[model samples]
Structures are given as C-alpha cells and as structure tokens.
Target: MYKIVEKEHFSENVVKLIVEAPMIAQSRRPGHFVIVRIGEGGERIPLTISAADTVKGTITLVVQAIGESTRKICALEIGDCFTDIVGPLGQATHIENVGTVVCCGGGVGVAPLLPIIKAMKEAGNRVVSILAARTSDLIILEKEVSEYSDEVIIMTDDGSKGQKGLVTAGVESVINREKVDLVVAIGPAVMMKFVSLTTKKYDIPTMVSLNTIMVDGTGMCGACRVTVDGKTKFVCIDGPEFDAHKVDFDEMIMRLRAYN
Candidate 1:
C-alpha cells in the first residue's frame, strides 16, 4: 500500500496528492505517468507524475475528479493508502538545449507540463509558457510554472484574469514576435488540436501529449491506439507524446466522444 503523504487543493474538483512511492519517484521523468488503484476492486486510473522527490520517496499526482475512479482517488485523505501504484510508465520526454521552446498548457494540462518546463530550463532552453483556462479560477500552477519559465503568458476565455482569448491566440502572438525552436502543448484534445493547427501555419516543430483512453498502461490493452501519419501507434507504449502535425485529430476526437 502506498500512503498519501500530502494533499493540496488546486480547484474545487482538482487536488494534488503526494504519495509515498520510492522506486517510482527515483525513476519517473518528465513524461512518465502512474496507474493508481484506490482499493481492492477499484478501477485503475492513470495519472501523470507532476513532480517527484526521491529523498522523500514520493510522487505528486494532480488529479481532477472527473470520473468515478478519479473521484474516489481524490477523495482520499493524507493518511490514506492506495491499494496499488504502478509505474514510471510511458517514454520520458527527450530534453535538449533547443533554443526557444514555447510550452503551452490548458487547464489541468498545466500540471503535466510542469516537469517538462523545469527540464527545459535545466537543459538551458529559454521557455515561454502559456497557461490557459476557461476562467481565472481554473488556471493551475501559475506561480510554480513561472519560476521555471523565462516568460509566462496567461489567458482566459472570458478575460477573468489574463488576456481574453484562447491559448492559440497566445501562441500566435509569440510565434509572430519571436523565433520559437520548439512548441509543446498538452490539454483537451480539441485545445491541443487547435494549438497544433496554429503551429502548423508557421511550420514549427511541435509535440503534443495525448491523454487517450487506456485500460492497462502497459500496452497490453489496445484502448490507447491512435493513428499518426496514417499509421497506428499505441500511446501506452509508443508514446503519450508525438509530433502534433502527424496525428489524426478528427479520429481521436471521435474516439474521445464515444462514451460521452
């Protein structure tokens, strides 16, 4: 059993939990994720490892209570223990000293982008980050993200906090004013799709993290298969990260809406 060591509210429905998982913490990287089960017979849910502390033997999970499994997990208190915690799963982001990287995040997607931003900075890249949400209250990791980014841009759909617009607008402004060497985005599939469309116009090198449906994170389950460049790839094993230009966004959107 993995004990919950800490919990912090990110929003009314979103919470961050730090769980005691030494081995995973020691090995998890920028893009690795964890599969968590709250108790016996509980459904397994995948969560990105937002942060890790090897010395403390803990991994940070930013969970949004959107579904039954996640709701159960987020309901857990500090002293509670999980039945299972599996992973350091998925390929780690390849960090390079790429000149200027514009990292984009929408809503809870910002949490997953945290480690990547820090890694980019450590690799000596100037990061211009964009954090977008429907309203100011939904934005995550503003102060923490700012610490690692060279420049941080905030946008809200209703002008509740930062600029009044979508993340794509912010991306356009950055690309127009500066030469962005790399662009990385993570968000709802629709949001990422639009961001990719924007970057495609400028022919920028863009990568996106695909939060596809998954049953087993080990590639045994084919639930996370996606078509990229007309070829099938499994997100669990092949990537949660992929070249944005090549992904078939329409098919992915349809698949995501299958149950909805």
Candidate 2:
C-alpha cells in the first residue's frame, strides 16, 4: 500500500496527492503515468505522474474529481493509504535539444505539462508555456510553470486572469513572431485537436497526450485503441503521447464524446 503523504486542493473539483512510492519515485520521468486504486473493491484509474522526488521517495499526482472513482480518491485524507499503486509506466517523453519548444496546457492539463516543460528546459530548449482556464479559479500551477518556462502566458475565457482569450491565442502570438520548432499540448480533446490544427498550418510538429478510456494499463485489453498515422495503436503501450498531426482527431473526439 502506498501511503498518502500530502494532499491539497487545486480547485473545488481538483485534488493533488503526494504518495509514498520510493521505487516509482526513483524511476519516474516526465510523461510517465501510474494506475491507482483507492481500495480492493475500487476500479483502477490511470493518472500521470505530475512530479516526483527520488530522495524523498514520493510521487505527485493531480486528480480531477470527474467521476465515481476519481471522486472517491479525492476524498481521501493526507494519511490515507491506497490499496494499490502501480508504475512509472509507459514511455517517458522523448526530450532533445529542440529549440524554441512551445508547451500548451489547459485546466487540469497543466499538471501533466509541468514536468515536460522542465525537461525541455533542461535539454537547452527555450520553453514557452501557454496556460489556459475557463476562469481564474480554474487556473493552476502558474507560478511553478513560470519558474521553468522562459516565457509564460496565461489565458482565461472569462477575462478573470491574464489576457482574456483561449490558450491558442497565446500560441498564435508566439507563432507569429518567432520560429517555433515544436509544440506539445495536453488538455481537453477539443483543445488539443484545435492546437494541432493550428500548428499543422505552419508545418511545425505537434504532440498530444490522449486520455482514452483505459481499463488495463497494459496493451492486452485493447481498450485504449487510437488511430495514428492510419494504423491502430494502443495508448497504454504505444502512447499516451502521439504525433498530433497524424492522429485521427475526429474519431478520437467522437469516442470521447460518448463518455459525456
């Protein structure tokens, strides 16, 4: 059992937990995720490892209380223990000295992008980040992201925070002025789709993380299937990350809509 060492509420609906998983923490890297179950009877859910501390032996996860399992997990207190916690699973983000990389994150997506941005910075890339939310309260990790980013722009739908617009607006501002080598986005499917579309026009490479309905965290279940580059790939193994330009967004979006 992994002990919950710390917990904080990011928003009314979003909760962040730091768990004691020394092994996982020691190996965790950007873009890696884990499967967590609240108890023996609970269903396992996949959550990205937002951050990790090797010496401290802890892994941080940000959970949005969207459904039954997530809501249950969010209700646990700091000292609570989870019945099961498995991973630094899946492939870590491919990082290189790609100059002028733009990382776009919206809402809860900000959590997953934190480590990715830091990795890009470590690789000697000028990391520009675009953080977006529907309102001021929904925005998270702005200060943390700004610390790693060479440039950070915030956009809100209600004009309650920094510049009133979508994240794409910030992307457009930067894209118009500079030569962006790559763009990485994580957010709602619709947001990612549009971000990919926008970058595709400029011939820049775009990558996105897909939250397909996953049962087993392994590829055996065939549950997290997605079409990329005209071939079927399982998100569990092949990717939670994929070339955004090659993904069949229409089909992916349709599948996601079914959950709503």
Candidate 3:
C-alpha cells in the first residue's frame, strides 16, 4: 500500500498528492509516469510524476478529476493509500544545453512541465515557460515554475490573468522577439496541435507529451498506440514525448474521444 503523506487542492477539480514511494522517488526522471489503482478491481490510471523527494521517500502526483477513476483517487485523504502504484515508466526527456528553450504548458499539464523546466534550467539553457488556463484560478504551480524559469508568461482564454490570449500566441510572441532553440508543449490535444503548427512555421524543434488511453501501463495492451511520422509507436515504451511535427495529432485526438 502506498500511503498518501500529503494532499493539497490546486482547484476544485485538481488535487496534488504526495505519496510514499521511496523507490520511485529515487529513480523517477522527468517525463516518467506511474500507473495507479485505487483498490481491488479498481480501474488503472496513468499519471505523470510532478515532483519527487528522495529524502522524504515521496513522489508528487497532480490529478484532475476528469473521470471516475481520477475522481476516486482525488477523493482520497492524506492518510489514505493507493492499492497499487507502478512505475518510473516511459522514456525520460533528453536534456541538453540547447540554447534558449520555451516550455509551454496548459491546465494540469503545468504539473508535469514543472520538473522539465527545472531540469532544462539546470542543464544551462535559458528557460522560458508559458502557463495557460481558462482563468487565473485554474492555473497551477505558477510560483514553482517561476523559480526555475528565467521568464514566465501566463495566458488565459478569459482576460483574468497575465495575458488574454491562447498559449500559442504566447509562444509566437516569444519566438518573434528572440531565438528559441527548442519548444516543449504539454496540454490538450487541440492546444498541442496548434502549438506544433505555430512552431513548425518558425522551424523550431518542438516536443510534445501525449496522454493516451493506457491500460496495463505496458506495451502489451496496445491501447496507447500512436502514429509518429506515419508509423505505429507505443506511448508506454517508445514515448510519452515525441517530436511535435511528426505526430499525427488528429488521429490521436480521435482515439482519445473513443470513450467520451
């Protein structure tokens, strides 16, 4: 049993949990995720590792209660436990000193992007982060992300935050003002698709993290399959991160709507 040592609500629908997982805490890298089950016969859900503390033997998970399984997990209290927690899975993000890097995150995607921003800054890159949400209250981890980023831009669909625009506009604004070597985007499928389009115009190398319907958290299920450069790829083993320009977002987005 993995005990929830701490819990905090980021928004009405989003919760952050710090759980006891010493092994995962010590081994997890940026871009790694875990498959969690609430109890016996419970549905498995995959979540990206938001942060980890080896000394505390804990790993942080940020979950938005978008569905049944996620709601169950989010409803748990600090002392509650997850019946199963499996991972440090998926390929780690390739970190390099790639000059100026712009990291774009939307909604709960900001949680997973935080660690990457920190790692990019540490690797000797000038990190600029763009965080977006529907409104100010929906934005998570602004202070934490800002700590590692050289500059942080906030975008919201409504004019309730730093800039009243889409995340893509923020990315274009930065790209127009200066040279950006790499762009890392994580968010809704539509948001990522447009972000990819925007970056492709500038010919900047862009990477995106995909959240697909995953079962078994292994390649055996074939549930997380995606097309990259017109070929089949498994998100579990091959990547949760892929070259944004090469991914078939339209097909992937359709697959995601299967359950909806």
Per-prediction tally of clashes: 0, 0, 0
Clashing pairs in 2: none
lDDT, ranked from best to worst: 3, 1, 2
Better of 2 and 3 by TM-score: 3
TM-score of every candidate = 0.99, 0.98, 0.99
List of clashing residue pairs for candidate 3: none
Question: Over 4 Å off in model 1, which ranges?
Answer: none
Q: Give me candidate 3's TM-score against the actual structure.
A: 0.99
lDDT winner:
3
lDDT of every predicted structure (CA atoms): 0.94, 0.92, 0.96
Evaluate residue 67 in candidate 2 and report its C-alpha lDDT on the 0 to 100 scale.
92
Off by over 4 Å in 2: none
- True-vs-predicted CA distance for residue 86, candidate 2, Å: 1.1
Residue-by-residue lDDT tens digits, candidate 2, 1-260: 89999999998899999999999999888999999997768898999999999988999999999999999999999889989998878888999998999999999999999999999999999999999999999999888999999998889999998899888888989999999999999999999999998999999999999888888898999878989999999988888899999999899989878877
Model 1: per-residue Cα lDDT over 1-260, one tens digit each? 89999999988999999999999999999999988897688888878999999999999999999988888888999899999999989999999998999999999999899999999999999999999999999999899999999999999999999899999999999999999999999999999999999999999999999999988998897999999999999998888999999999989999989957
